[model samples]
Target: MAKQALGMIETVGLTSLVEAADAAIKAADVTMTGWDKIGSGLVCGFFVGDVAAVKAGIEAAAEAASQVGEVNSTLVIPRPHEELGQMGPWIS
Candidate 1:
């Protein structure tokens, strides 16, 4: 498959992460690429798709997550570098 754009939203808790994930999928055509749980109760959701869709999805997710709890960070990479692919779901 061709390389896909990547989107991410990291929230304070699992429930918030789920909320973000739901909004992301609803707002755009994307697929869950990965999920991560970091210490101190941080939860991260990752999605991949077309550039525009990924941007929309991540933005929607961040907005939804913020409504629930603290949003640690958000990322939208239109065309992720090869190094980022190797990094995968890593929080660092």
Candidate 2:
């Protein structure tokens, strides 16, 4: 099943954050849907082929981000459309 993981990271230095982000992206085997900087933090959007990939991606991103600053992450295992309702459309 497909999986998605979102990462929120706060960095003390911009250079470190950028470097970490670049490393994380390069390290990832999964597809990265999006990535953006918010203030002094970062938001990473990723899609994976399976649960294992999702977990691995999250761990990799966290490890890389920690080199720069603090990292916080959330993984969402989406349910069926009917269960998600409005959230389904947003995710898609």
Candidate 3:
């Protein structure tokens, strides 16, 4: 089985994060875990799937979100550490 990967897209506004989540869902076979508000108008969207899909999803998300608002940062962790799951629901 392929190891699951985690993808995150952080944006400067709720609308950007929402757009990122939508684009990620449509562009790849990943599952949207959930999103969180990071204060200072920053929001983050999370997703999980195979490494390639996660990477693809995040890339698509960032591109789509940048059109409407600021994309602060994006990350993809392939085969993330199991301990990370204990942090929150979005990690797994």
Candidate 4:
């Protein structure tokens, strides 16, 4: 199997994260790893798939989340190092 890429979208609210997750899932063949709440209403959604698919998913997620609330940032890491998985369940 191809090494999975990781995609993340951070937003200011749960609603925005929900929107982001929806768009990400619908836009590409990605699996949602999970989500995290950073307190102060900040939330983040994570997805994993092929590099191209992850990049596409992140783009769609950011756009969709921004429409509903504040999107802080988005990231796509192609073939992230295995050690990253130790950081949290969301990274895998």
Candidate 5:
């Protein structure tokens, strides 16, 4: 099974945050599953080959964002099919 990872990052700016997240994702050599913005902050979404990559991605993302200012991040190990199961549940 493919290990899944999710991250929630609180940052100051959107553009820079996304850029940082992107760079971090690349550095970690992982695929970016998705991403979005919430208020003035950003919520980065990503998936990797293993738990280590996910953890590393989060750290790298934080480091990139920190270049500008404070950046807080949270990561989670998602259950397989949970994401898909939850999809569209609240859309309508």
Candidate 6:
């Protein structure tokens, strides 16, 4: 597998997460991995790609999500541990 970096963008709702994913993908060479719900109307969009691409993707996602709704958080994990990638939701 390629050396993938993981990006995550947390939004106030699933709708915002969807918009985040769309803009993120359009802005960078990244793939939407999946999503996780953290309750209380919080949802997170996951993406994986090259380190720089992941960073760019998450930045775009954050900006897009912030425009339509609230953005809870954003993160980019470059060269994430293999065990984390083995997690079910991280499989993409």
**Per-model TM-score on C-alpha atoms:** 0.86, 0.51, 0.96, 0.95, 0.65, 0.92
Q: Cα deviation of 27 in candidate 2 (Å)?
A: 3.7
Counting clashing residue pairs in each candidate, in order, gives: 0, 0, 0, 0, 0, 0
C-alpha root-mean-square deviation, candidate 3: 1.4
lDDT per residue for candidate 3 within 1-92, as digits (tens), equals 13999999999999998888899999999999999999999998989999999999999999999999999999999999998998889887
Local distance difference test, per candidate?
0.83, 0.49, 0.92, 0.91, 0.58, 0.88
Query: Which of 5 and 6 is the better model by lDDT?
Result: 6
User: What is the per-residue lDDT of model 4 for residues 8-39, given as tens digits with 9 covering 90 to 100?
Assistant: 88899999999999999999999998999988
Estimate the Cα RMSD of every predicted model relative to the unseen true structure: 2.8, 4.7, 1.4, 1.3, 4.2, 1.4
Please report, as a residue range, the 10-residue window in candidate 2 with the lowest summed lDDT. Answer: 1-10
The candidate maximizing lDDT is 3
lDDT of prediction 3:
0.92
Give the poorly placed runs of model 1, Cα more than 4 Å off.
Answer: 1-3, 89-92
State the lDDT of candidate 2 residue by residue for 1-85, as single tens digits. 2244333334445554555456555666555444445553444444443445545655666677677666555454533234443
Q: How high a TM-score does candidate 4 get? A: 0.95
Worst 10 residues of 5 by lDDT: 83-92
7-87: candidate 5 lDDT, tens digit per residue: 445566676567666756777765665555556564444444456676777778778778776665656454445555354
Give the per-residue lDDT digits (tens) of candidate 6, residues 8-90. 88899998999999999999999998898889999988899999999999999999988999999998888887778567665
Q: How close is candidate 1 to the true structure, as a TM-score?
A: 0.86
Which candidate ranks first by TM-score, i.e. highest? Answer: 3
Candidate 4 has its poorest 10 consecutive residues by lDDT at: 1-10
Candidate 3 wrongly placed segments (more than 4 Å): none
